[model samples]
Target chain A: MLQTDSLKFSYPKGQTFGFPNIGCKAEETLLILGNSGTGKTTFLNLIALLLRPSSGELIINNTQTASLSEKQITEFRAQNIGIVFQKPYFVNALNVSENLLLANYLGNNALDKGKAAELANSLGFEHLLSKKVQELSGGEQQRVCIARALMNTPKVILADEPTSALDDENCEKVADLLEKQSKIIGAALIVVTHDHRLKSRFNNQITL
Target chain B: MLIKIVWKNIWAKKLNSFLCILLMMFGISIISLLINIGNQMQDKFSKNISGIDMVVGAKGSPLQLILSGVYQIDAPTGNIPMSELQSLQTNPLVKQVLPLSMGDNYQGFRIVGTTYPYLKHFEADYAVGVVFKNNMEVVLGATVARKLNLKLNESFASSHGFEKEGEAHGDKKYKVVGILKSNNSVIDNLILCDLKSIWEIHEHEEEHANETPEKHTEHANEATEEDFDITCALVKFRSPMGLMTIPRLINQNTKMQAALPAIEINRLFELMGIGIDAFKALALAIMLISGISVFVTLYNALKERKYEMALMLSMGGKRTKLFFILMFEGLFLSLSGYILGVLLSRIGLWIASRMLDQNFNFDLQQSMLQKEEIYLLIAALLVGIFAAVIPSLGIYRINISKTLAND
Candidate 1:
């Protein structure tokens, strides 16, 4: 489970943001819909522990993250948080399988090649595991990104604008994959995007 | 995994990495070559001049005396009366003395009229036949024998001067009776003959000149056994008293000047050190520039890969791990360059030794690694780490949210 309470953040230039309290249980999906400059990515970054909230309480798997040290937060984030970003960014130098293994490496876990292959098979990109990221098509790259995020089986999966650049078919397929993968891992799935097509796909919704 | 990532990153920027490696290789090769050549040459020079305490020759440049009498690399200043050297040899403070009679060459190898003691001093042994036992018989040094392709019983006419192409001593030829083993010393380049042969050759030249009345000088009739002369005499002292009194006594009382090999060699090194030091500074400057290029390459790469860095950071990679990835790139480039540089320097030394052997009969093929080179490697690593750390510090400043959100 992932929960946030009255999350607030401010940039050095004096722009402050106050977000509504949000909560999601394991195997649930939350859709955050917002237009440009809605601080949707900032909210995801805070829950990812990438950006420390100025004033907030972030609880993931029943552990409060606000008071954790920097190192502890980084470790905790690596072990329990999975992020799928927009545009399907993978390390250009690594093959598809190595990209997934990188997630395990960063999470301080022994590389599970079997888990990577299984995820690749489930995501329908097992044949593309040895190929470079640039060799993959748009849909294949999205599927690899989903597999990479699910590598550590984190308690919360956050995605930023994951379907904004895809076609209607690929976007729905990606949304379904993200939900299906998170449900299989029993993790809370949170997606932030400006795409209005995802609003009906998710029952729990927030608009900014 | 980190190493693999670093390798891939370097391969991805192949051109930039190659440029850095080339620059480093150039700098390191220059420094290593300088050190190797300088060390080998100094070692050879010191080894060749070790036993002789003082060189007594005609009053002239002391450096020329040491270079000619001990190292046999320079022309003799002039000849001193053999009677004068004989008296010095008998002095109580003098343990031994070896007279050197130069002024003739057989195919560019100097013919030194010295005794068995000189050969023993260098620990030379005959590789073929036996040592010269007669006035016309000769024993060739290893290099001379090999280069001239001379064998026992082969005869070659001596040239009148130090140069290879000088006027020939037409009436007489010296037969090679022996060839010396390679001893890696000055003796390896000499043509050894009896002192009587040098005197006989000069006497015959004087007699021939006397036949032409117009060219005859008063000294034509002065050639005799008692009045014979030698170019220089190498002196070794029996004790410290000889070192204190012998050279000064010779300088003050005799027409000949005494040159201490140690002092003259030191002066020669001091003069040559200026050039070596300048070259060393030039090598160091090139290394510094290479280091700066590494810094620029990595710094630009970090700037260009800001988004990638942010993505790695968001994947829960520590900033320090990303920093090390860049550091490893720099270390890998410098280490490869250093290894190649060392090998190239050894190749350079081998080529130099071959050329020197062909021309000067000096061997410089000692390809052993020096302690200074280990220090150089450490310095290179420090330079690599320092150059990399400056730019990789940007990892700490990367705002993952801003970078990811903006991209």
Candidate 2:
């Protein structure tokens, strides 16, 4: 579960962002929509604990993240939260399967190759395990990004513009996959996007 | 797993990695080869000149006299009659006089006619058979015996001079009576015989003199001793008194000239040291540039992989962990280059050894590991770390949220 109350952040005299309080439980999906230049990325970063809130109560799995030390914050974030980037980037030297296992390795969790393969199988890219990341198509690469985020089985999964580059067909498939996987792992899923297509699919929604 | 990443990342930039390794290898091999050749030549030079104090020969270049008389590598400076060196040979300060006559050669190995004391000078022991008890009996040096495959009781006639085209002294043959152990000196390449054999061989050039071979005691006569000619006499003094006055006395009062072996060889080494020192400096410069290239390769890689760094950072990979992984790349490259360079140097040494063996009767011992080689390896590793340290620090500055958001 993840909860945030009156989260506020400022970028060194550049801009201040005052966000709404949010509460999402296990087996839940929250869709936050915002227009361009509306601090969508900043909000995602604040929730990722990459940037410490100026003032807020941000909690994940019932632990207060605002009070955690820098080292503790990194460890806590890695163990409890997973984020899918707006655009996918990978360790180009690694193959598709190793990219997935990287998350577990970086999280200080035991590498589970079986879990990676199972994720690939469910996401319809099992045969592409040995293939290089650059060899995959746009849709395939996006699915891989999704699969990687679930490697450590975090309690909170954050998706940033997950379907911004996909067509009508891949956009729905990736959304359904994310929702289904989060339900299986019993995690609160948060996806921030400007796409109208996903606005209707998600009933629990907020706008920035 | 971390090591694999380091290795893979290095290979990912193929041209950069290849260039880096090639530079370091060239630098290392050049230094290694210089060290091997320098050590071997110095050891051989000092070993050959150890006990000898002076070389007295007919008038010529002192360097040539030392080269021919002590190292047996050059032509002797004309022949001196044995009578001229008689006074110096009997002086109170004179310990021993080794009369070396180099005229005849079997195949290409010089037949140095000297006494048994010459072998004692070099500590050359008999490997097989006994010392020659009669004239015209010869003891082959270890390398000469092994290379020419001459065995005990085999007889071979000498050629007139060192060249294969030199006329043969086919009238009489010298029997191989013994072979000496290898002492890694000039003697290892020579064939030793009694001085009487040289005189008899030269005197009988016109008269069919093998028929008068029973006159072996001719050396005992004063007339024959006065008439005999020797290329040079290697002299050892009992004290420093002889070195000061004997060479000056011989050069001024007599027709023969005296040269100190130590001074001549030392002059030669100092001249050659200039070229060697320059080559070593060039090699070191190349090594420094190679280290810089490694730095550039890693730095560019870090710049290009900013996104990947941020992604891994966001996944909770410690900056220090990523830093160590990248640092290992430089270490691996340096170490691999060092291994290859040493192997190349050995190959070069082997080729040189073969050439020296053929031309100068010299062999370089190859199996010995040089202390400089070990030190260079450690230097290579330090260079590796020094090169990687700056670029790997870029890991800590990556802003995971900003980088990922911008991407």
Candidate 3:
């Protein structure tokens, strides 16, 4: 579970981002919708613990995330969070398997090669695991990124415009993969997107 | 995983990586070549004069005596009185005295006249014919024999000076009595003969006949007499006695000056030492600059990859892990550059040594990669780290919320 009580964040001196209070529960699919200047991405970042809230208590899994030291915050994030990005940035030189291996390494977890392979195969990435990240198509790269995100079996999945670049068919495919994977792992699935077509797929929605 | 990422990143910009490595290789090769040649030159020059304790010559330049007597590459200073040489030979401190006379050249090499003692002093066991015995008999250095293609018993006339075309000692042909083995010394460029042969050829030269014809005639006809003059005398002490006493006696009592081969060579190295140090400093600077380039490039890449970094951060990659990831990239680049540089340098040295031997007849032996090269490699790696430190800070600054929001 993630809780942000009276969360206030701004880019600089006068630019405000997150609202004063926002929270999302575990195992729920969140649809955060907002106009360009509102703090939709900022709220997701705050919830992900990547940025310090200007003022408030931000908690995840019963721990006050905002109160944790930088090192502790890093450890907490590694153990509890997963992220998928819109453009699907990857370490281009590495093959899909190697990229996933790094996620496990950064998480301070022993590589469960069998589990990683299983995840890849179930997500239809089995043959693509040996290919370099740059060689994969956009949809394939996004799936690999998703596989990377779930490698450590974290409790929260925060996706930022995860399907923005994909075609309608591929977008649904990616959303299906994210929703199914999050449910199987028993983690919160927070999907941020401008596309209203995904509203029906999520069980929960947060309007900014 | 860190290594894999770094490698992929590098391969992504293959041309840039290749360019950087090529530049490093070029720098390394030049340094290696210069260092190796300098080493070989010092080795060959020192070996050329190894056995001679002191070089006694006419009262003029000591360097000239060393160049002509020990190396046989320059004009003799002048001849000394035979009586003076005889008196020095009679000294109880004198172990062996090999008199040298120079003034002629076969092809472009100096023809040196000395006794069998000179060959023994250099440990020159003839590779092909017997040692010099009769008048006008010449022993060829390994290089000289190979170059002119003159085998044993083949006769070649001597030139007056080092030039190929000059006043020739055409009247007195010197038969090649022996050919020496490759010694990697100045001796490899010389033609050796009896001291009397040099005296005999120059005794009646046109230039000498114009000024000192009577003096030449006096020495030529008075061969039966105990009077003679040699260009220089190579002296080895019987014990430490000559080392302590002979130089002092020669400097004070005689007109000739005795030069210690080791001391003069040491002085020469001291003079050249500054240049070598300067070259080393330049090499250090290049390595430092290359390291900085690596750091700056990676750091810049990190800034551009901020969103990606934040994505990783939110994916549960720790700040410390991210930090190490950047640092390891730098380490990988520097180490690869250094290794490549070393290989290039070694090859360059081999090529340079070959060229030197071919052109100068100065044999430069191929040496192993030196220990200092390792230090250079370490320096490069450290520089790489220094460059990466500032940029890796991006990982800590990446705002996961903003990055994910913007995405």
Candidate 4:
């Protein structure tokens, strides 16, 4: 399970973000909706442990995150959490399969090519495994991004603007895949986006 | 996995990496070639100049006199009378006077007519038979015997001049009596005989045809004072007083000119140093430019890959790890360039040795790697590090969250 209490962040000479407290159980899904300038990305970053929060009690698997050192936080994040960014970015020098393997590498997990091939096969991009990521279409890239996030099989999966750039059909397929994959891994799935179509699909929801 | 990524990243930009390596190779190759030839020339010159204090030849360029008399690589200044050296033989300042008369060749090797003192001067030992005793008999240098396949008791006619195609002095053939051991000196390239032999050959060539066998035998024993002429003479001073007084005295007082071997060789090196210094500067500039190219390539790559770097960082990759990845790229490029450059220099030296062997009858032998090139390797490494480290430091400053959020 993942939970946050009194989460607050302040950018220097910029607006301070005050996030609402929320909790999501493993194998469950939570959707966060916000328009531009609503600190949706900021909230995701704090939960991702990418940026230090001004003040907060952030917990994942009953470990208090605020007391963790920077190095420990990076280790904890790598081992326990998987993040999918809205825009599909990759180390373009690498192929699609290598991109997935990069997650296992950075997370300090064993290099498991079988797991990468399985993720690609399940996400319906097995044929495109050796191809460069830039060659993939928008929907294919989104699915690949999801596959990359699932490589380490962490306890929590956080995706920001996961379906903002997708059409109606791809949006439904992506949302179904995200939920099914996260449920299969038994991770607390968190989706942060301004995509309104996702609201009716997810039972638990938050608006900033 | 890290190595695979580094390879992929470097291969992604082929032209940039190739140009950087090319620049480094060019820089290293030139310096290596110069070092090889410079060292070989210095070695040959010093070995040949080892016991001689002064060279007295007919009035001409001092450098030419040193080259002709000491190294035996240039044409003689013209002949001086053997009587001119007689006074020096008696002078207390002089230790030894070795007269040299060279006006002919056997094939491409010059026939140097001198006394036993010249062999003693170079410490040349008899590998076979004995030293030349008869006027027309010759003793071959070690290389001359090896190259020409001439052996003891072998008779070969001399050519009229320095070239192999010069008119043959077929009537008076030189009989090889002895062959010298490998001495690694200028003496190794000559055919040694007495000074009287050179005089008789030229005098016979001048008044040729219809000479009876009786007159041939008579001319050998009838060499007078006027017939005594030598190309030049190498002088050794018994004391430092000879060096202080002789060169100036001979240069000012007589038709003969004295050249100090040490001074002339040093002046030759100084003149050569100008061209060498210019080329060295140019090579160093190319290396600097290569370093700059590496800097610009990585700097631009960092700017363009900030998103990828930040994304990797968010995935828990350490900045130092990424920093070393870029460093490895630099290391590979420069090191490969260095290896190829050293190989190129060896090939260049081989070609140079071939050309010198053909033209001057001198071959340059050098070791695989010189002392300076080891230092060059270190220099190349420093360039690689400085070029890579500056740009890779940018990996640390990447704001992971902001970069991922914006892009």
Best-first order by lDDT: 4, 2, 1, 3
Worst 10 residues of 1 chain B by lDDT: B214-223
Best TM-score among the predictions, by candidate number: 2
> Compared with the true structure, what per-residue lDDT tens digits does model 2 show for residues B1-407?
67767876887888999998998999899999999999889999999999999999999999999999999989889999888878987899999999999988998999988888998899988999887778899999999999999999999999998876699998889999999998788888999999888877877773454435444344335355766789999999999999989999999998999999999998999999999999999998888888999999999999899999988889888888999988998888888888888999999999999998788777898956798888989988888889988999889888888888884
Please list the C-alpha lDDT of all candidates, in the order they appear: 0.88, 0.90, 0.77, 0.91
Interface RMSD for candidate 3 relative to the native interface = 2.2
Candidate 1 contains a number of clashing pairs equal to 0
lDDT of 1 by residue, A1-208 (tens): 8889999999899999999999999999999888878888788888888888999798999998888999898889889999898868777878899999999998899999999999998888999999989899888898898899999999999988888888999999999899999999999999998888898888799986
lDDT of 1 at B171: 85
TM-score of each: 0.89, 0.95, 0.76, 0.95
Candidate 1, clashing residue pairs? none
Worst 10 residues of 4 chain B by lDDT: B218-227
The clash number for model 2 is 0
The digit string of per-residue lDDT tens for model 3 on A21-78 reads 5566666777887776677677777777777888878778888876798778877888
- Which candidate number has the best lDDT? 4
Candidate 2 chain A TM-score vs. reference chain A: 0.98
Local accuracy of candidate 3 as per-residue lDDT tens digits, B1-407: 66666677778767666655555555565566567767766877788777789999888778777877776656778888667878878888888888877767877777888888787778886789988888889999898898889899899888887677877776778898899997666667889998777776776564455666676555656463246677888898888878988898898888889988888777777878888778867776666666666766787678767766776776567777778888877777776777787777777766776776555555556577766566666666666678677888777777666555554
> Higher DockQ: candidate 1 or 2?
2
Estimate how well candidate 2 is docked, as a DockQ score.
0.78
Candidate 1 global lDDT: 0.88
